[model samples]
Structure formats: structure tokens, C-alpha cells
Target: MPQTNGNAPGRCAPIPKTIPPMKDLTTENITENVIALNNLCSDPRTRYLFERLVHHLHDFARETQLTSEEWMSGINFLTAVGQISDDLRAEMILLSDTMGLSLLMDAIAHPRVPKATEGTVLGPFHTHDAPVTDNGYVLHDDPGAEQLFVLCNIKDTEEQPLENVQCDVWEGDSHGFYDVQKGADRQGPDGRAVLRSNSEGVFYFTAVVPVPYPIPDDGPVGGMLKLLNRHPNRPGHIHFMLETPGYDKLVTALYPRGDPYETSDPVFGVKESLIVDLSLVDEAVADKYGVKVGMKLLTYDFVLASDEQAAELRKDRRKEAAAKLDVDISTLHLD
Candidate 1:
């Protein structure tokens, strides 16, 4: 007979007398038994989440007829995900991303805000240590990178310029590698900066056109992608995080029009609205942005939604995230 007392080795507290003892669990009864005990979870939301999680997880095992070896393999895969994660690399986020869960959550959390910019995945490469620089900042120096000039103008939904906005920018080099990927944690920052928009609600930066690259795959998430026969390529793009008073912070990226990988970005970060056009600018235009002549000029304009509107839109999902997602939202790229 199974022990019902909390005193049993490695067991939880004794069941309350009001509830009957659990019978031996079978395949059909196991899910229900787990849920029954999970009802004791004090947080109403956590209880509901556990109920659903148990149902779907058990159902998956049953429907797939998952074997013991396969189950052990899954366990080992998760172990590797935990083992490889650190401050520099987040394997869990990568796993959620590879499985399309991150993008799905992004879609749910961030809905369209009239004419405002759309949000996308905050890929695993963003860093907080990017230095604040002047408007016409040079962010990279890769010999192989094609010269590019970037201009961003920020406005509110009503089309009025919003000055003093902080724009955090980052991108990969011609070879498709971020400074962090190049071991910058030891070498210090490159290819990223925090810029302030001027009176015209504009910020300028000199960069190399981003190129497609495989996400850091040498880990458990990569192995899972291989098993699923999926490609891990993301399209060439520039990431932007815009924040200013009384407006919702926008986390978004702009994909250049011609990347072949745009159609199949493994993380599903691409949307038609996020695609951008580039122009080869004259010397005068290049000088305005403080870069040398012949560099391609890419201009992207962004509109931000007010805080009031974003709060209303995000209330539903915020409740779930507040219910102990086991993550510090600040630490995760999705924030």
C-alpha cells in the first residue's frame, strides 16, 4: 500500500481527512490524481495552469505512446538545456524560441496598436551593457562588412514627433555575428549602442548591413532542431528597442527586403510590416548621417502607442506572467 502520510519518505504532507485517500494510479487515472493534489496550490492561476499542463503533458505521452527510452531522452535533453545556460547564453529561451512558443507568446502579448510599430521576438542576443552614444554613432568596424547608414524617427500614434526617446540598437556584421557572439564578454562591447533621438525625433548610426546567420546551435536546442529536421537560420535584420515617457516601449526588428531566409526565419520573427527598403545614397545624404559616401541608407519610421492603450491590451497576459513563470522578465529577451 502507498503511504498517505506526510511523514512518508520524500513525500509531501498528509492528505486532509476531508479528502479520501488516492487509489493506485493507472494510465487513465494518473492525470486526474495529479490535478486533484494540485488543487491545493494557493494561487488560483497557478492551480489552473498546473491543471492544464498536466492534462496536455499526460495526453501527449498517451497519444504518442512514448516509450521509456524516448522519455529518458527527453529528460536528458532538458538537463542539457539547464546545464548549458548561463548569464551569457540562455538555452531555455532558445528552446522556447526553436519550438515557436516564443513567437506565439509575442503575438498574444503584443497586439496591433493602430498605426504603431509591431513587436517581434527579442532574440537571445540583446545585451544591457551597450553604451549610450551621440546621435551619429559608429557601432561596428568589420573589414568585411558593407557600409550602411541607419536613420530612425520616432513619433506618437497621432503623428507628432517624440523627442528625447531612447533607442537601443544592435545588429550583426557582414559575416552575421554579433559582438557578443564574437566573445565580447571578455573583449568589451561592439555592434550595439543606446542612442537618443533628437528634436526631430531622430537617431543616426553607422552600421554594416546585417546578414543571415544560424542561431547559436551547439546546444540542446540545436540538437532538438536537428531531430525535427528544421533549419535554424534567421534573416538579416536590425533590432530596435524604443522607450520614452508615457509611451509603450517597442521591441522590434527590421528585415531587409531581399534576404532569402526571410520567408523561413526559424523563430517566426518576420512579419510583412517589418520588411524594409534600402537605398544606395549620394555623398550628400551620407554626410548628413555622418558616414562616408556610397553607403546604403535605410530609413525606418516608428509610431508608439500610449501607455494607457498598452496597459489595456496587455492585462490578460500580464496576469498569467505574474503567476510565477519561474523567470525574471528582465533577464529574458522577450521583455
Candidate 2:
């Protein structure tokens, strides 16, 4: 037996080396390691979100035992989605809408907003500024279908009327193509308008009854549709974005008369409250609205949410515009 002294370096006892068990390095262990990596993030919100995302993503991978080949395929799909994007298109947002994520998020964020008209996804084609028109003007730039008059009113949740509100409207022609999509040089508010409500809270516009048409399926989103055996069509509807000083803005669409896809809008934007009945009437009613006689008339009411909610709705539009520009919004210092 060798004598050992605690104070002398040469006689000191051997130091104990403890190693973590190998079983602790399973998939769950790797997940915990990934979460720990989030400590390197300086932004609190980013760190919190990335940590949770890693946990769930790792859990999902482990549960499915996802293979490397499958993971690489997903990466390729995403890469194609990004490569397909250009100045006039947004494949990622379209993908989200087609998968119903956009609608689900909208439902959660805009819960039970009273007097506030239901909000829907604004598709990727909204022009920054539509041509400003007066109370009763036509928005149809290229003609293809029968004329229809849209008479709408803006009111608060209490049913009290609101005036001086801004209403932006846009829709495709009977042929199912927006003016912007028609040609590269043909982009200048061709089929869009921004109108102000009258003193009676009424806004009137004349246009052809839009026909149900397929969304652009010539890109990656289209490939997804082909794979899923789904059509990229949306119902015939007129888009509306209304805003007032003290009320929530309403982003919605009004389905046309007897649209085939009304029940199966690809974007899940159809709302029972937003549907309008286009009654075929004699020329008398049409003449009063400065519209052609014998054309159908669709009348609907737009109820706005509170002021705070309206602001939030507008914020979404601003974000969309910023994304299209592909610039760092924080650096822009925009008002």
C-alpha cells in the first residue's frame, strides 16, 4: 500500500473523472442540445421562438424518423419556391394561403372583433395605390362580362353609419386576369380604385360581375396543386379594403351571383356574412345608380371594427408591401 498525503502534490489522490451516460445522448438529448444553442441568440423574442421551434421540429422529426433523403427533398422544394419568386409574384405567401395557414392565423388574431367586419387574406396581387375615384365610378378597365353595380355601406358595429371612410376595391376581369398580370408594362391601377364613402356612409361602384377564375398556377404553387389534385381557382368575388378614422378597417371580398367555386374558395376567404345576393332587376333600379339597365345589382353592407383593430389591419398591408420590396423594414425608418 502506498501512503498518500493530501497536502503534497505527488501524494495527492487521483481525481475522479465523471462522464455523462451514453443513453443521455439519444434523440431527446440532441434536442436538448439544440435548445441550449439558443442561448447564443441576443434577441429575447427571437431566442424564445427559436427554442420552442427547435423543440417541436426535433420532436416531429424523431416521431416520424424522417430520413435524410426526405429532408433534402423538402429543402429542394423550399428552394424552388424561393427561386420562383420575382417582382410580381410571391410563392411563399401563396403556399401558406393554399395550405390554410394564412386563414387560420387570421382567425386567431382577429377573434370576435365586434362591429368589425370579418377579415380575409388579401392575396398577393394588391396594388400599393389604386386609382382614386369618386363615389360612383367604374373600376372595370377591360370589358368581358355583363355589367353589375355594387352598392355598399360602411357602418359601425352599433349599426350607426360611418362617413368619409376610404374604400379600396379591386377585382379581375371576366377572363380571370388582373391588369398587372396581363403584361409587364401594363401596371398602373388598371382594375383597382380607392373611393370615399358618401355622407350617408354609402359607396357605389359599377363593374362587370366577376367570374370565378384560377389563381396563377404556372409556378411552384401550381406544382403543389397538381400534386395534391387541387385546383388553384378562387370564386368570383370583388375585394374590399375599407378604413375609417375611428373604426377598424375591413378586408374582405363579396362573392358574385352564382359563383361555382363559392363553396370551395381556394384561399378560404368566403364568409356567410360577406356574400351578397345579386338580384336581376328591371332597368328602373339600375338607372338610379347610373348603371346600365337590365344588369344585375349586388348590394351589401360593410361593418367596421373598432379603431384599434382597423390600425392592426392596416399594419398587415404595410408589412406585405415591405416584404415585396425585400428591404430591411427597420432600416427604412418609415412613418
Candidate 3:
């Protein structure tokens, strides 16, 4: 009888010629396997989505030759992101914003319309319960910061003024700190407030020139940026959310012409139409808006989409968003 090599000390048998190699996989078969596994999902949409997601994810891993260690690192990073989330902060939104997914989704859901203000990412700092005040309220009363006058005209496509619309505005202070980022000792809402557009659809506020600032980078997303050799800075801009009956809610930001990072906003929130110039105001012009002479002023007119138009544009988005929010699509309005 022939003795196998395993009988020898520290030796193993040679592989049998009859043993077959591991099964070879083709692209079609790889994707087909995932589809077969998920085709039984209870929900048709879920099944379709999971199948496609699995196919693409698998293809990406194979194409990149992803190592097990790298995969583990990604999982660890995501775990960290979830671990650090809280009511005041959402790491997932930050991640999505940094990746430009937020802006992409906004664009897809709210396609641009003629004369309507372009949409932008609702940055991590927006609060629904911003302190409501009359027009011309001061948002940045902190001494020594340059004062800026924000005068915005709210209008419809036909250029008719929109009254009773609330404009929620917020921004970072000169030192790049938002109210929430500062400690409890810091006074509330350092650079945020809500004001209503006047009868002529004009809203005005006194604020500090928002300085360029980095998104919160003390977390996993920041670590990813470091690994990618990318900066975490967003161009200075004032966030605006406009809401009213009979019109679509608008979320947008205004970028100054010379903000250092205007052209290279990390979040890709800048749009040509959203960029405006801040000019020095003469005493007469300044007195017109109630600000003292020699202050800076930014004037912009925002055209809001009518409710009917917005509903038509985001019909599918409404349903999807409603499902996620556990609300009826018919009850969802653009606010």
C-alpha cells in the first residue's frame, strides 16, 4: 500500500489530483447570488433595494480588492459614529453633508425652478425652535464683531411680495462658534433668530459677518477627512429657512463674494444664484433699514416656489419622506 506523506514526521500528504479547485465566480453569478438571497424580502421595494445594494457593494469590494482589515476599519468607524450621536448632534448628517450626499438629495428632491431660490444643505446647526423676534432684531450683539445688515425680499415667481412668511436665520460667530458649540455659560442663540417677512416681503436683521469655519471635526468623520488628506472647512454663510402657508418651505444659504472658501465649500452648498455681495452702506441708505451709518449691508431677493409647484416637483420625495417620518404623504407640506 502506498503511504501518504502525512506518515512522515512534520510532513503532509500531497493534494489529490481529483480534488477540484474552489468554485470560480463570474460577475453575473456574484450579483445573481445576492438577488436570489434577497428576492424573498417581505417588501417588494425593500427586496429590490437590497438586491441592488448588495450587487453594487459586492462589486465595489471585489474591484478594490478590499482587505478584511480595511473592511473591519470601516465597520469600526461607523460604530463610532453611532456611539457619539445625541439630540444636539448628528454625526450621520455630518457624514452625509461632508460627502455631498445631502446636497445631492436636496437637488434630486427639489429640482430648480425658474426664478425660485436654489436650495442648500440644512447644516448641522439649524434648530426648529429658534427664538422668534420682530424684523431688524440683532443676532450678533457680541461686542467687537463687525455688524452686517441682512435684508432679504421674499417673493413669488411673479415677483409679488409674500407676507407673513417666517425666515429662520442662523450663522456662526466671528470666532466660528455656534451657540450650541459653546459651553453652557455661553448665552443662548449667539447667532440665530427667526423673523417674519414684512408686508412687502422684506425681512431685515442685524448680524455679525459669519466667518469661515470647519464642521465639527472631533469625531469619526473628521478622522476620515484626515485619512483622505482633506480639509474640513465650510465657507462662511448664513443659513435660511423660509416657511409660510400656500408656499413651499425653502432652505438656503447666502455666500459672500469673497469668503475664502466660497468656491471650495467642503459641503458643496454654494450656488451661483445664492452668492451675493455685501457693500458698505452710506448714512442715508443705512438709516433706511434702521442700521447706523457706515455698517455693511447685504441685499437679496428670494423667490419661493408656490405650494402647487413644490408638490408637483417633490411628489415622489414626499411619499418617501412621509414613509420615513411615519406620516401620511397628503398631510406632509413643505415646511
Candidate 4:
């Protein structure tokens, strides 16, 4: 049999005859030549993305006049980022969020719908197996933390109630620690739940008011943030993810209006339109949501986009992106 490689006792096969010769590399010609290496990629989307990526990378290296030492340092930092990440934590996502790329991609992919809800970044801590709970459920009841009741109303773009929508509610506790962040000995779900909307398109649950929390700062991303003179803290916000059969799934968070870090969330996840007005309630109002006499109440509404509407929006955004690259929209992948 003809050998394809040096597999048996140092016997080697000859090089393929079909390979093309590469031009001698220089700063001026390397970018185009590097892109040309992928000219045979079967996937159009991969080819399109990689061509632009290589162009920008070359430009960046030239613009900064990057040193070999600096490049090595970057490689070491990325290696550490991968080394320290496992099932529980996501250092890559942390790096992206701190650099604002995550939110930028989110904005491009989820361009605003005319009357539908807005979405923010899906942070790394979202868990899939949060316990299912009914409406009027109490998500938390810790004596050390002030009480909070969350009321959510779901509707369609035409203002029609959407029944049976899946709404996931999750947040860190008063101390800004999620259940998974607590490590292996955690007992059960803390400050998170899976819920379905009732017939009226409403769900009410008792939870503690989320406190502002810093993203994990012990990893490479944290060190990078410090070097950049930035803080890793995000504003106090409760996450909500809504899903239904015929509508676009919404992944969003509602930030309370008065958090100190609202103006400077490091991850760039907050939006002015998503900020909700929080109210302090007396015993009479608190009694309704089963909270303490002096607690907080948060009520927010959502409007979902239909599958067709969301698809159209995505197509339009891809067209805009393709236009910027001077590529045919038909050649660009929609998702």
C-alpha cells in the first residue's frame, strides 16, 4: 500500500503534488497570503470570517508594532486562561466580556426588534438544571438579606398574552455569590429557578434583591482588567430568559435603577431600557408577595418577537454586516 505518512519504521511518503507554493512572506504581502491559505475551505462562512480576521490581525500587529516579547506574554496569558478554566468557570468568556467583545457580538446578533424585548449578554454562570417552581414561589428566604418579590408579565408584540412561556430567573445572593461559585459542597439551588408563565402571562416569585457583584477576578481576565485600569464589578441585576414555541427566546436581565456601578459595568451588559424602577413596600404591599414588612418589589413586562420576525431581523443584520465587508449577502451565513 502507498504510505500517506512516515508511519512505519521511518518510511516516509512523498509530498503531495497538488500543493501550491507560497510567496516569500513580508509584512506587506503576508496578510493576503495568509488569507489565501484558506482559499480552498469548503465552508463559505468559515472562509468569510477567517479572511476578515486575518486582515484585522495583520493590521493590529502593524499598528501597534508589537514586539516578540509582548506577543509571548499574550500567548502565556491565553494559555493560563485555558489552564484555569473547567466545567464550573469559563475564563474565555470572562476574557471576552471584560474586553467588551461579548456584548458587541450580542448587539450585532440580536439587533433591536420594534416592540420586542431587548437582550444582553448571557453570563457564564447560567445553569441548565435549575429547579422548576410554580408562580408565587419564594426563591429565597434568608434572614440576613432583605426580601424581594419579582413579578413578570409576558406578552407578544401585538400585546397578546403568551401562555406557557419558559422564564428562567437567576442571580447571585446578597453577598454576590452564585450557588455554583460556592464550590463542590453546595447543597441545592440558591437564587435561581425555572418557571413557566401562567395563563395570564404572569409569574410572581419572592427573591432577594440582587446585590452588585464582581466578576471572578482571580484569573487572567482579572489581571488584564487591572492592567487596563478597569473594575470587574457589574450592577445589581436579575437575569430572565423567556422561551416559547413560536417566538424568539429572550435572554435578558433587569438592572435596578440606582446601583452605583450602573454607569460603568465592566462587562457592558446593562442597558438603559432594561433598567427597572424598584419600589419599597410597606406591610400591606409586602403581604401580597409574602415578603417582610419592609422589603422591595420589582415588576417588569416583556414583549416577545415571533420566529418569523426574529429571522427577518437576523437576515437584515447579516446583510448589513456583509455590506461592510463588500461580500455578497447570499454568500454569508445567516447565523
Best by lDDT: 4
Better of 2 and 3 by lDDT: 3
Model 1 alpha-carbon drift over 4 Å, by segment: 1-20, 315-335
Cα lDDT of model 2 by residue, 42-132, tens digit: 6655766686688789888998999999899788988998998776677888888898888877765555465567878788778776888
Candidate 3 wrongly placed segments (more than 4 Å): 1-45, 183-187, 314-335
The superposed Cα distance between candidate 1 and the true structure at residue 47, in angstroms, equals: 1.6
Rank list by TM-score:
4, 1, 3, 2
Taking all chains together, each candidate's TM-score versus the true structure is 0.86, 0.79, 0.81, 0.91
Q: For model 4, which pairs clash?
A: none
Which candidate's TM-score is highest?
A: 4
lDDT of 3 by residue, 1-335 (tens): 32233333456665333222223567557676557646645666566558658978988988898899999998999999999877667888999998999999889767776679999999888866578999989997578899898888999999999998989999888888788777455556668899999999999998888789998899999998888888888888899999999887899999888887888787899998988889877887676776787788888999999988876767767677779967545454433
| Backbone clashes, each candidate | 0, 6, 0, 0
lDDT of 1 by residue, 1-335 (tens): 34444543565666553433577889999999889778767776577778779999999999999999999999999999999888778889988887789888877767777898999988888999998999888888787778788888899988999999999999987888887775535487788999999999988888888889999988888888888898889999999999988998898999999898989998889999999999877878766765667679888889999988776666645556645665443322233
* Backbone clashes, candidate 2: 6
RMSD of each: 5.4, 10.9, 10.7, 3.5
Off by over 4 Å in 4: 1-17, 281-294
Candidate 4: 10-residue stretch with minimal lDDT: 1-10
Looking at model 3, which ten-residue stretch has the lowest summed lDDT? 15-24
**Model 4, span 1-335: residue lDDT tens:** 22233333456665433334565799898987788666557787788889889999889999999999999999999999999998778989988887889999887767788988899988988888788988777776466987687878899989998888998988888888888787787687778888999899988788888889999998899999999999889998898899989888898999989899999999999998899998876787567656666568898889998988888989988888788978978667775
